[model samples]
Target: MTQKNTEDPSSQKNDSDCGCGGETGCRIEAVLSVDERGQMVLPKDVREKAGIRTGDKLALISWEKNGSICCLALMKADNLSCMVKDILGPLLNEQDRS
Candidate 1:
């Protein structure tokens, strides 16, 4: 049997607002189960809301705490690449001066 989460939604912080100082806060969008083929489907409404389409590529990112996996995140490949470049570009330039 599946157990339901009993946490209060209002007590949770919202991560959608990045400047809110809550980096780990997020709302549960949906609960999904993996199939025998190791595939899970994103809910229709969630997909639509996120503008995900059939041919879209996603980058799966896993977060580890204490050497164990704690969380998973997904972003479009294009966005992920842009984020990586934005974060690394300045650091790379600084290293070049050394």
Candidate 2:
């Protein structure tokens, strides 16, 4: 599935001329199955590269856009808030006015 954004950090290509010239920008497609207990196994390489651990905190986010549902995991607290604000800034301001 493809997603578009005006200017997205994750969407930036890993081209040789781009900021992330390494394979970090490469997207590895895989099928992840959620377990009966609502658990999914993140690939080992991905886990290591992301520095995710057994007890580390992760923010699970799901959203619908362009007629498709998308899910993502955020590892950092500040990043999670920034992402939420980016997606919900208008709504957040409206709520503040009440």
Candidate 3:
């Protein structure tokens, strides 16, 4: 399944790609099933389009709402560091002044 983003954040896919585009600007890209071993394979076309290659690592992230896990997102392993910095950079800088 392919989805188009009728909004910003093109290709960056920075954990917030949302990929769901339509009247609501959000939709499911694919439905994956986990095996008994708890492993799911991403389709080849999606992987190729995302530049994900063999041996590439991914991070599974989840969002909590009302104290329950409500959403999930997958991110390239390498991008996690940059995301951490982007989130913590300001807080770290602020701490330096203390």
Candidate 4:
């Protein structure tokens, strides 16, 4: 289900490029479709750019706004683990000292 974005950037209809008429740092990279089995394939380009390889673990993170999920993100499991440890490790140590 991988497809290349052949559309030319210049020909893009949206004049909302940016206030400076330059590309924005954050923009849509690819659109993915989910199959009947609820399986979706991340575009090859996005996967490669993100350094995702076969069998790599990704944690699907979601953000809730006003009780509704507003955004979704993916992070490497190992990095997520490191972040959790960095944030909670100190708190746990403080509790142990208490």
Candidate maximizing lDDT? 1
In model 2, which range of ten residues has the least summed lDDT?
A: 14-23
Ranking by TM-score: 1, 4, 3, 2
Please provide, for model 1 over 63-84, each residue's C-alpha lDDT reduced to its tens digit, 9 standing for 90 to 100.
Answer: 6656766678788898999999
Q: What's model 4's overall lDDT?
A: 0.80
In candidate 3, which residue pairs get closer than 3 Å at backbone N, Cα or C atoms, i.e. clash?
Answer: 20-25, 20-26, 20-27
Candidates 2 and 4 compared: the better one by TM-score is 4
Candidate 2 per-residue lDDT over residues 41-87, each given as its tens digit: 88898778887777777776555545565445345555778888898
lDDT of 4 by residue, 16-43 (tens): 3323233535556788898999998999
**Which lDDT values do the candidates have, in the order given?**
0.82, 0.66, 0.78, 0.80
Question: Which model scores highest in TM-score?
Answer: 1
| Model 4 TM | 0.65
As a TM-score, model 3 comes out at: 0.61
Give a tens-digit lDDT track for model 3, residues 32-95. 9999999998898889877899998899888665576767878898899888999999999999
TM-score of each: 0.66, 0.43, 0.61, 0.65
> Which pairs of residues have clashing backbones in candidate 1?
none
Pairs that clash in candidate 4: none
The residue ranges of model 3 lying beyond 4 angstroms of the native Cα positions read: 1-25
Overall local distance difference test of candidate 3: 0.78
